[model samples]
Target: MVLKRVRANFKRFIKSNAKGQTTTEYILILFVVVMVALKFRGLMKEKITSQMDTLGTKIEQITNDSE
Candidate 1:
């Protein structure tokens, strides 16, 4: 009887564990996405800055040519 009870408990434990595994997987995926975003943050900033600089240069040239 004790063995049967233990087996039943084990089955419940496994079912609960399966639910936890999916949440754990999602958390891991979120962590990886955050890490990747952090890793590329500098590159993204540089690209945006470079684009802004190019735009500023074009605007300055247009103003100078008008004058």
Candidate 2:
């Protein structure tokens, strides 16, 4: 599922004489990370909202106790 089209302009990155991963590999890795984040955005948002709601409830409880 790699975007081969994006690799054409990345030939220079592949010309590395070293054995480690090249710039092209880094780009592909970042693309995968972005894709994963996009896929899980809804779940992440839900978790964050739930956490915030709990925190707000706790704060309200503390305020009531202090009063």
Candidate 3:
């Protein structure tokens, strides 16, 4: 029957090469993460720079006090 053949083919397709499909999914997720990072790259840079500046100021104050 036509319906039986279609069902059988669908099952076969679903069973075929599951490992490859899983890898593809992982790669897709990584791509999305990378894209998001790129989109926020400027914001991340500014925040990191601000934090570093604050850290440097604190370190300078500590050294001056010890001296």
Candidate 4:
């Protein structure tokens, strides 16, 4: 039946790729992290480069009556 073919395929896959499973998982995770970093690099740069009125500065200004 179809179930037998599926099971056979599953077994074959498990046997063939099991050895490199950890390395594969790590590479996949690293790829995802690199992709996300690349995607957000511009946004992070903007946040860091911003010189005005962040939350901490605002709080300090209010406390010191400089606002």
TM-score winner among the candidates?
Answer: 3
Badly placed stretches (over 4 Å) of model 3 are 1-15
Report residue 45 deviation for candidate 3 (angstroms).
0.5
Better of 1 and 4 by TM-score: 1
Per-candidate RMSD vs. true structure? Answer: 7.6, 5.1, 7.0, 8.4
Note the Cα lDDT for every prediction shown.
0.91, 0.81, 0.91, 0.82
Task: Sort the predicted structures by lDDT, highest score first.
Answer: 1, 3, 4, 2
Candidate 2 vs. true structure, TM-score: 0.72
Q: Which window of 10 residues has the lowest lDDT sum in candidate 3?
A: 8-17
Clashing pairs in 3: none
lDDT of 2 by residue, 1-67 (tens): 2678667545644565343356557878999999999999999999999999999999999999999
lDDT of 4 by residue, 4-50 (tens): 99988867775788665666678889999999999999998888767
- Look at candidate 1 and give me any clashing residue pairs: none
- Which segments of model 1 are wrong by more than 4 Å? 1-19
The positional error of residue 63 in candidate 2, measured at the CA in angstroms, is 0.7
Between prediction 1 and prediction 3, which has the larger TM-score?
3
Q: What is the Cα-based lDDT of residue 18 in candidate 3?
A: 93
